[model samples]
Target: MTESATDTTPADQLGSGPGRVLVWFYGVFTVAAASRSIVQMIMDFGKAPLAYVLSAIAACVYGFITYSLVRGGEKARRAALVCCAAELLFVLVVGTWTLADASAFPDATVWSDYGMGYLFIPVVLPVLGMLWLRRAKR
Candidate 1:
């Protein structure tokens, strides 16, 4: 048996296969980061403004990547790739900053300690996302 070009269904897009898993992960992070930031800000913004703000930023990045992955196209894939790279950089910078100057954070951002609170998933996810996006390009 042979499959034709039309066999490419919607499920065969970037959001399918491994991309589906990536979307799920990104979606989870979006909610986690957003809610955590919101609660922290509401509870005591003055306590750790920098950490809360960073968490909010992480939430936005995660949300955008989630949307792009689900949207599924070359453009969306490229957008996701860029976001993933940015996410990785954010994690690295914030992680190092938090360590180098603990007083500046007061509390932990989503990327603090290299995502230690989240079992390092935040740090690893973007790397996996970039790789997946690259693979989907071909």
Candidate 2:
């Protein structure tokens, strides 16, 4: 048996590089997402179903991202990309709308304040994670 020319032998070096950054971001996101959802769900599940559901979704995505990083491969890479992209979209839309109309968001989601609660790291990390995956795929 032999390897394909398309094999990313060199790229995997990043498994220990700033890809560690991807790992860190995923870790942070996982904790943040989980905590936020847990808090909201416990405090007042009936407050906003849409927002709470989205929060739960975000937590699941974060967990997926974390798992993908720990188990890197083509499939994990794709999963991580999809998760991060969703996070980016979530943050952008939630951030803009929440700021524009404060009345609508009775409480901030994990993506609120442009992820200011997390120093906007949540907003930026996903974009970075996707870039890292693209580079690793190269």
Best by lDDT, which number?
1
User: How do the predictions measure up, each by TM-score?
Assistant: 0.91, 0.83
Model 1 regions more than 4 Å off:
1-12
Q: How well does candidate 1 score on lDDT at residue 125? A: 99
lDDT of each: 0.91, 0.79
Compose the digit string of candidate 1's lDDT tens values, residues 1-138: 898855654533777888889989999999999999999999999999999999999999999999998877778888899999999999999999988999998899999999999999999999999999888877
lDDT (C-alpha) at residue 110 in model 1: 92
Q: Could you give candidate 2's per-residue lDDT for residues 17-134 as a string of tens digits?
A: 8888778777777887888888888889888756676777878888888888767777778878888898899889988988999777787787777888778887888888889889
Q: In angstroms, what RMSD does candidate 2 have relative to the true structure?
A: 3.2
